[model samples]
Target: MKKEIHPDNYRPVVFKDMSNEEIFISRSTVNAKETIEIDGVTYPLVKLEITSSSHPFYTGKQKLVDTAGRVDKFMSRYGNRNKNK
Candidate 1:
């Protein structure tokens, strides 16, 4: 309800889900370093690692996303704990 409190740079931005390559457009003021053309129009592009479109909670399916070998690193560090038993 306050004037000049909200950002004035809100514009249509394209958000892409890297895991599934799903894209949707929404208004946002976030800065983007890329651009994407959809339907002959260019919009600021933002890449996301995960979103509701590719999330397990919304799709009811379990999925693993490993970007920095985190899963493998954790597995290597603790995967053999129960092997000796």
Candidate 2:
């Protein structure tokens, strides 16, 4: 708990998740160039690439990779060489 070390310019800021377009309002000392109006109030808008609402772990929306297709492709390209040796 240090005094005069923390910033004193805490203000309301809006964080917008770019991936899912989720907006959250919280107090922060970070600066932002863009402004947005929400619920008749204006707040500094900050754009983020990922947030809890859009994150794979939080939203439980994991991307499924086609591992079988990749295996098949690898086998097609090099499987014959192994069989000859």
Candidate 3:
């Protein structure tokens, strides 16, 4: 409640390059580089590689587990099996 001693808490925070599904409630956690432009006003845009829209878990689509079949092959080689059984 002290004046002139409080930290600056009034700064514009915006996250850029977010997926279309996460833009409405998205806010930047810290200052980031963004290059956003709207109505002649431009700001920095954040670039994200993946979000709920692109993530495999959130979208309910399983990602390709390329190593899955390899595991079976390994087990067969290491594990001993009875020839008649």
Candidate 4:
């Protein structure tokens, strides 16, 4: 351990999984632009596309997370190439 090497801004932050709307609290130093109140206590809100709770590997299920039509765009651009084979 070293002195004055760790960040001092560690605090409780709320991480929300956008796919399943699952939320959990953990201490972090990451900056957040949004806030959420839980149990009458306000905490920084961080939105996540996927987490262990909703991930395919952790949940043993297949899931497709498409944000802003990214998956669609990718499929359109590259998916058709394989179909001709």
Instruction: Give one digit per residue, the lDDT tens place, for model 1 in 1-85.
Output: 9999999999999999998999999999999999999999999999999999988999999867699999999999999999989
TM-scores, all models, native as reference? 0.74, 0.72, 0.43, 0.74
Query: With candidate 1 superimposed using the best TM-score fit, by how many Å does residue 41's alpha carbon deviate from the native?
Result: 0.8
Q: Which stretches in model 1 have alpha-carbon errors above 4 Å?
A: 64-85
lDDT of each: 0.95, 0.91, 0.57, 0.96
Tens digits of per-residue lDDT for model 2 on 1-85? Answer: 8999999999999999998888999999999999999999999999999999988999899975677699679778987896887
In the range 1-85, model 4's lDDT, one tens digit per residue, is: 9999999999999999998999999999999999999999999999999999988999999856689999899888998997898
lDDT of 2 at 48: 100
Clashes in each model (backbone N, CA, C under 3 Å)?
0, 0, 6, 0
- lDDT (10s digit) by residue, model 3, range 18-72: 4453432244445566565656765545566677676778889876555768867
Screening candidate 2 with a backbone cut-off below 3 angstroms (N, C-alpha, C), the clashing residue pairs are none
Candidate 4 lDDT: 0.96
> In model 4, how large is the Cα lDDT of residue 49?
93
Cα lDDT of candidate 2 equals 0.91
Model 3 TM-score, 2 decimals: 0.43
Q: Which stretches of candidate 4 lie over 4 Å from their true place?
A: 64-85
User: Candidate 3 — which pairs collide?
Assistant: 16-46, 34-44, 34-45, 35-44, 35-45, 36-43
Q: Against the true structure, whose TM-score is highest?
A: 1
Q: Deviation in angstroms for 77 in model 3?
A: 9.7
